[model samples]
Every structure is written in C-alpha cells, then in structure tokens.
Target: MTAVLNAKTVNYYPANAGWTNMWTAFDPVRINTDLAKAAALGADTVRVIVFPQTFGYPTPSATYTARLAQFIGLADTNGLDVKLTLFDWWSNYTDIDNSVIWALSVLHPYVDDPRVITVELKNEISPGDATAMAWARQLIPAIRATLPAMPLTLTVDGTSGAPGLTSLKSQLATTPPDYYDFHFYGPSERSLAEIRRAQAAVAPAPLVIGETGLSTVSTSEGEQGAYLARVYRAAQVAGIGSVAPWTFNDFAAGAIPANSSVSTQPAQYKYGLHRTDGTAKFAATVVNGAWTSATTPNSILNLGFEAPTANSPWRQYLPQAGAAAITTDLPRTGLQSARFTGTTRTGSGLPSLLTSPITPVQAGQSWHAEAFARGAAATGITELALSWFDINGAWISQHTSNRLPTGTTTWTLLTVDAVAPAGAAGVQLHLKSGDNTGTVWFDDVALT
Candidate 1:
C-alpha cells in the first residue's frame, strides 16, 4: 500500500465575497494565492467539496463537466495532490438527484487527473450502516469502471464504532476501499482511541483522521494547538497514514450558500488556522511542527487499520507503525464520563488499546499528565506502563503507577510535572494495570 505522507492537507477559504459560495477555478489570481499559501504551509494535498447548491443543480450535463475540468486544471497548476469530494450537500433540507453522479460521469476526464488522489462520494453520512453500504456498492464500482485505478474513499461523521462498523462491513459484498476516514471532536482522547480500536477490528487498509479541529467560538487556540499535537502523536503511533484538519483559514461572508446553516453559525467564522482578519492562529504553529518534522521528538502518533462503510463522508490517511493519538482543543461538551469496569479487549476482530499519546513538558511549557488509577482486591498493580514516542520517532515507556493498598474504591490522581525531555516536542499518556478490576476516571487532560 502507498502511504501519502508529505504533511496532511489544509483547507483555505478566502474572505472575499466574490469567490465565496462559488468556487470558480477560472479566477487565476484567487486560486493561485490559495494554492501558494497551502503549499507554503507544507501541505501536499487539498480537499474541496462540490455541493449541489454551490455548483448549479438540475444544470446541463455539459456545463457540469466543464466546471469539473476547471477545478482539475486549477489543482494541476498548483502542484497539489487533491482529494475531490462529490455530492457534499449535508443536512436534510436540500434535494439531490442521480443527475449529480451522471454529471460526474459525463465529466469523467477530470476524475482521472494525476493531481487527484481520491474521489470522495459524500460527507459525514449519519447512521452510516447497511443502507449506506448498498448505496456505495452501487456507486464505487461504477466510478471505478470508468476511472480504473483511481482510489475511492468514504468519510463518516465520527469514529467507525459509533454506528457499528462490523455490521456495515457485513452488508458490503465487496472489500472496503483503500482507506477509511473519520472525525474526532472531543473528550478528544477517548474519541480518538475509539477510532484506533475500530481501525484494528477492520482489515488493514490505510486509516485517516479525515477531520479534526477546535471550534472557534467555543475553544481556545492554545487548547487547539495542544490537542493537535496530542492527536498527531496518537495517529503516528497507530500507523495511520495521514490526517487533514478541519480548515485552513477563517470564514468569509460568501464562503457558503446564502441559505447555508454553516454560514449562519459562529463556528463558520472560526475553526481555521488563521483568524478572520488574516491573522495566524497559535494552533497553526503546532500543526506545522508536527507535519514537517518526521523525527521531531514528541511528535503526534498516527494509528491503525480498518475500512469505513460505504457512503460515509469522512476519510483520513492512516499512520504507520501503530495506532494514532489525536489532540484537539475541541471539547466534548455534553458527553457523559466513561468508567472502565473491566479491562479493554485485545484480539483479531476484537478491540484493543494499542497506542498511548505522549505530550512532553518543555521548560517554559506548563504541561502535566494527569489521570485517575485504582486497584482491585488487595494485590498491587505492577507493570503499569505509560509509553512516549520521542522527537526521534523512538518509543519510550514510562511507568506512572505505584503499589496500591486496595480494598474499597480508592482513586489516585497521578500527575507528572516535568520539563519536556530537553528539546522534546511531544509525548503520550498511557496507563495499564497488572491484575486490577477497579474503575478509573480520567478527565480534563490538558497541556498548555
């Protein structure tokens, strides 16, 4: 399998009213600037969704093909690998007909462009179950028959576990695609870890953390940086191939359609690497650091294998080596706390906690690894392991648990406060028990 690892792509949405809502590649100056800035940020790829409303619907087939060519021509000139998304009209209000796919078929030449790496069918299809697979089974092969060797990818809203990936796979008679993708919002670690497990349970196609980022209106930029570092580390260790964060720039007035709900939300203006006024956000620096340096100690870990169900709207590049660790400023607002009653499972086709994200504390950086641990019966838990992958891409294990005098429910919060291993860039926090059956509660893990 080929791993596309030249730094994940970033989204660029210009604030100018003219280019918003409509993506006209014919506008040379505007397209050039967007591509130039993306390449400057070490990005080798770019993703854009063609929603029905943005690009005319019930439009003439010939006209649609012409538009698709314009987009392809633009990407080729920009020297970027592209992940082109088709039929990205999210929400229930809009109506999309089969003509959209027919239009793509008519404009089939663009789908085969060298600059285009994968052609995504949709974005974040909810309840991505059998029905979705049936839809994909009908769609993917049809596209492949025309485009032959081009990779086809599907993106889901959340981790594969949310809607039961196993069942989705059972419904599909064909093997999963080249890669599976998903998104992670918050309780960031928990959501990421779940994605890793889901990948492991599925076959070994490359995995991708297709989308992740802190919401502009609700989270801090600093927290976003911290989460990006953590998530990247986890993804690397998990052997995930690649990751693409939410977007590259601040929102603009005409970025989306006039009636678009996203255009009305505050999050529409934020969730970018740069602020609305052409200013850079702190998270951008952290994301850049992780992307450019492969051996930079404390780098984010990428993780696992597993195919996403068909028709799902998320796709990501899986990390190599093992599972991935994803850190994000996006907070898990209302998700209830989870308590571990028994140890997690491990086996082929079964879930396993294979990777641990490490966040190294630097001299000036105020960072701590805090989590709750408990003991069962009267036996002390030994071999409690916490592994950290340093800047050099080497995995180092650290133990954070001591002997416990157990009996009742005893919770101990272990905090490690230290300077990031001199010149360290990232670290993962892990906890493993020897022979314990007690619940452990972990929350609000942060490094600022």
Candidate 2:
C-alpha cells in the first residue's frame, strides 16, 4: 500500500522587526519590510506585540487601534496568519501599564479579524500572581461577547513556578483560555517530561510552547541553535501544537538592561535566531529545520506512558525522543493497552497503525489513550486491533479499525474515548505492520 502523508500544518514565528518601533513611533516602511520577510520565510503565523505605553494603554484611543489595524491590514495582504500578542508589559513595555480593559479596547478589533487565530494576552505573568489570569478573564468575555472568532490564550512562563505540572491549573481554572501557552529553556529531558506530565492537569485544553532556548544567554550562537532545534523537535514529538523560538532577530547592544551586564560584546546578544545586522545564526537555521520536521533522533514511538488527566488528550502528546534521542518503553501496565513504534526516525519516514478491539465504555467516565509512533523507511500502511480481554484472557470484541497513517520519526496522536470503559477490566492496542522494514518509534502511553 502507499504511505499515508500524515502531513500537518506548521505555525512559524519570524521576526516582527518593526514591532519595537511601533511602541513610540509607527514606521510604515520598517513594518512593511518585516511583514514581507515573514511571508517570504514560509511562516503561517506572525506574533505581533502591542506595547500599552506607546499605544496609550488604559485609554482606548482611535489612534492606537488605527496603527495596529494598519499592520493587520499588511499581514492580511501578504496572506500571513496573525497571533496578536496583546499587553506586552515587559521592561521596554513598562509604559503600557497593566490595564486589561484598555488592552481590550485597542485589541478587540483585531480579535475579530479573519487573519488572527489567537490573542496572546500577556507575555509571561509572574508566577502565583493572577495578573495574566485576571486579564484573560476580563478580556476573553468582552471579546467573546463582542467579536468572537479565534481562540483566546495567555502564555505562561516556566510552568507557573516549577510549581511543576499543576502549577498553572489555578490560572487556567480561574479563567479558561482556549489554549495553554508554556515556555521552556535548557536541555534536561526530565524537565520536558515534567512539562508533558503537567499538561495533563489542564487536560483537553491545547498546549503551545511559546518560547524556548538555551538557559544561559552566554552560550555561543551555534550551540544555542543546535540545542534549540533538539528541544523544539522533542517538543513536537511530545505533541506540542506549536513551538515559537524566543525572538527571530538578534538583540541590539544594550537594548535590554537586565542582560546588558551579562554580555558586553556586540555579537553576544542573547536568545535571537539572527544577529543585529541581520546575520542569520546557527540557532535560526535549527529553528527553521525543526519547524519542518516530522520525526526525532530515537525514531521510536512508545505509547506506554501516563495518561492525560486533562479534558483534551488529542491536543497533547507524551514525551518522545529528542531530535537525536531514542526510547522503547510502552504503555503495557496501566490502562491495559500496548503501543508499537517504528524505527525510521526522520521527517520523511513515519509509520502508522490501526486496531479494532471492542470494549464496554461507560457514560460520564472519561478514558483516553495516546501513542507516539515513528514512520517506516518508505510509505506503507497497517491496521491495528483494539480488543477487550476477559479475566479468562479471551478476546471479547473489537473497538477500533486497522487503517493508520504513515511517516518517519513523526509523533502523531491517536485518541479513542476520554470516558472510561464499562464492565471491561482491561484493553489492548495491537499494531500490525504493513511491511517487514517499516519501523516507527512510540512513547508517552496515556490511558485515563
């Protein structure tokens, strides 16, 4: 049989070069140039920041909205999607103050725009503080009631305190946005695992890695880019919907005060894909490479990890291997299911499977299963058998079919039911490969 494409849309973040100038002064040429570049770079979405101070925060003036609309118009004209970042009160953004209502006033128009997919309320709200949450609550409702179109979101910094997985649940619960915006730095696989586990706490809600980079800003640009690619690809296999690196352009000398003391040299600008003079660094290349990847280093999909406690399991995937890492664990104990992985770990060779096993499901009881499978060397097909076993070890019935997609090193998610089964002690998910050499890696087995 032919290989299934398993092709998904990619969300890209390029440099919004003119965004800084928008704060105090709006430059048409600078803004247009940046937008044009983003469009040319194959980006489906561009994140735009609206600093409150420069745009007259807390006082809805027509001028601020007009200036923003001009940029939105440009984006629409270029056929690029927008992920409008609102109320960026970072250090340079201090003048914007913290008035979500004012943010709403200036941002509501774009939220209704067809080009926008989501509204990023705040950059990184201080952990344990409800500032971003408060803002989201006030804004989403107003926008939903007035001009509801795309989803509303707030990006969280570092899982709300290494407070671990459930740390941000409070914010999400208090004011539910459409997706969970999370960030990560460093190269620890354990931390990435924790981030994946924490995703369960906000089950059902989509998760996006808004920022990622080397923890230490002093690292060489080449090392930063390579590490960034590794982590970003890991994130993709681990089932993150989108991953946007910190910034696209290089940081200007002394442009940021906090880090100014860290590096005095001109080329030492930290956490950028490119240098100030538009020198594309190694990190930029890594991001570009990972953005288009469908597989990882280990290339095996093990579907035997913990299940997602979140309401939505389809939106998230458990941790797989890094772009260069590998694993072979499966979901063999809990949830009574098994997952199989293929060996062709790359963007081109992903293997897929389908299964049929009848199981009794109960109403109001949520049960979910997730798989991380790699693709085969070439295109092929497979059917899986999902069956229920009685205490006597006999097959009772079939649950799902046997037609799976095909790809290599790609981490794809297959979800059945979020509600638990009725009168069934255990369930099994078995895969039948289409060919002898078709290998797919699997991990992050979840059944809840």
Candidate with the greatest lDDT versus the true structure: 1
What is residue 108's positional error in candidate 2, in angstroms?
A: 3.3
Clash statistics: count for each candidate: 73, 70
Minimal lDDT window, size 10, model 2: 1-10
Model 2, runs deviating above 4 Å = 1-21, 90-101, 130-136, 159-165, 188-191, 215-217, 254-268, 293-448
Q: Write down the lDDT of every candidate, Cα atoms only.
A: 0.52, 0.49
In the range 1-448, model 1's lDDT, one tens digit per residue, is 2634333766554555322254543355665677676676667787766655556554634555566566556656776777777666634223233643553554376554577777666676543444556566676666776776777666666544534444444444384555666666543433334456557645565567777776656655655655666667666766775778777777766665566566777776777777657566766766677777743233222111111211111112121211212222211222322223344333321111223344323323444545444443423242223334443445544435343345544555555654444433334444333233443322233232
Q: Please write out the lDDT profile of model 2 over residues 1-448, one tens digit for every residue.
A: 0000111112222233333444445666765665665555444566777776667746856776787777678777776667777666543333233454676577666654667666766676654654544545566666666556557666656545235325555655755777766666633222344445546766677666666665225544434544554555556546665666666665554444343343465433456665566666655545555545533322112234332211111111111211212232422244423333332323422233322112222223454554544454524544333445442344566444334576554555554553323443334554434342444444454434
Candidate 2, residue 96: the lDDT equals: 31
